[model samples]
Target chain A: MVDPTESPATGSSIRHEDHGDDLRTVRLAGRLDMLGMEPIALKFTSLTASHAQQVLVDLREVSFLASIGIRSIVSSARALESKGGRMALLVAPGSTVEATLTSTGISEVIPIHTEEAEALAGLGAAG
Target chain B: MAALTPADELHIQPDPETLRTASLWLAERCRQRSVPQELIDRLDLCLNEVLANLIDHAGPGVLEIPVELVLDPGDRRGGTPLSLRVRDGGAPFDPTAAPSPTAPTVLAETGIGGLGLVMVRRFCDEMHYRRVNDFNELTLLLAWPQETPDR
Candidate 1:
């Protein structure tokens, strides 16, 4: 089941959608800076904990990506991985978000796909 | 040598909200000057990390003293490096001297404490830190592309 309500604590909008077959998609939009990471991190951790198969993080609408934001994603990915699950990120090519992910060497650890289809395929969630 | 005057300056409270204000200020300045988006993003990232560190570790005194950011676009026509100076009147903490965190090979090994400094080091072309008087001043420099020439 997807949580449609956005938490006001983080000031960033995050909602989850169940793709069926135990696959889930969490879409995050707005700035993912220091202030915005707190609620998102908590929500993401809880979501990943509940859905143990696969979680696709869509960062297409994330206009800003900071170190703390990266930390949140990495931490959530780690949490999911521990439960035998995986997290993949969808980032547009040539975006600041993509560049930050690459420079921080996050792209090496997390699978980054430019297209939704590619990310789904990589996560084995393709229909 | 002509004294480098700050193109802009901001005095902000040492709070998380400053990150958003600082980023917007930097972005607007970059857009007006026709600075490349890549440089703008790097600058924004570095500023956010640096400010976040100060806010997190600068102790309670940071609330009493305002954090200052000075932007120096040195000879934009001649391709001199753009510099940002973040001044905080908190306990002396030199980020440049801090141990660089090794990039974790796996997800579980990734801890959040030292990664900010690592990103600051990697993105900025030059970094210098000085504790003069009671202020911790950290400066980051980025080389402007000569080919683009601010257009």
Candidate 2:
């Protein structure tokens, strides 16, 4: 379990690992509501701004996601798109997070994959 | 009619930090009632959106007026529905009046605003708003799924 104490923020913690070939995978855990979106949004925007290639956000561990959280993802994805980069999301099957993304039509704008390998491949193929 | 006590109530300052506190209070109440995780997630999401909207749009006078959250459960249509009433004396605003933004098809046209209200409406089964005595009261209702007996 990713501890919320890991970050100074109360609701979320984000950790990224380089997946080789310039692909970055970010794993987010905990509630991604208004209180949680601030720090994570900054980091996510920075990652997409700096990388500008392929960034896969894995939300399988995320227990809750609100509109602010959705805004962060949309903003980051838009930022990447402006620079000809791409953002993909890994959402667990049948999870509430997935349902929220689907309901907001975000899944249509950004590619959503249930498997990490597929998300990486989709992003890889985009480049 | 007699005044009824809420199952749980929270008085909070209209700020970003208090959003988390409110969620925790709801989570604790749900835990005590053995609410399912999925339903709990829906409640948390709606709570965050509603509270964030109040904090962002409700003006500086909102600071003087503490936000109130009241949680109660009642039987509705043969299922127990959880009700969350958010009362704020900040300003007169009706979220239901806000136009729902259409989902953008293209990434470049995607917007950040108005999506919060959309999520609040999408997750909760029912939503209502009223201005009473200079207070904005928004009520969100979610019907809990019928639980199956253990085999």
- Chain A: TM-score in each candidate? 0.87, 0.89
lDDT of 2 by residue, A39-109 (tens): 77777777665756888998998888878888888988998888878899999999999999988889889
Interface RMSD after interface superposition, each candidate: 1.6, 1.2
Positional deviation of residue B36's Cα in model 1 after best superposition, in angstroms? 2.2
Query: Among these predicted structures, which one has the highest lDDT?
Result: 2
lDDT of 2 by residue, B1-151 (tens): 1223346789998677888788889999888777777778888888888888887787767766888898885553356588899999876889889899988899899888888888888899999999999898999989878767679
TM-score of each: 0.90, 0.89
True contacts kept of each: 0.59, 0.82
> What is the DockQ for all candidates, taken in turn?
0.64, 0.74
Instruction: Please give, for residues A1-127, the per-residue lDDT of candidate 1 as tens digits.
Output: 6575455665588888877766788899878887787666777778765546788899998988888888888888887888789989999888888978877778878888999887877777432
Off by over 4 Å in 1: A5-11, A125-127, B1-6, B148-151
- Model 1's DockQ? 0.64
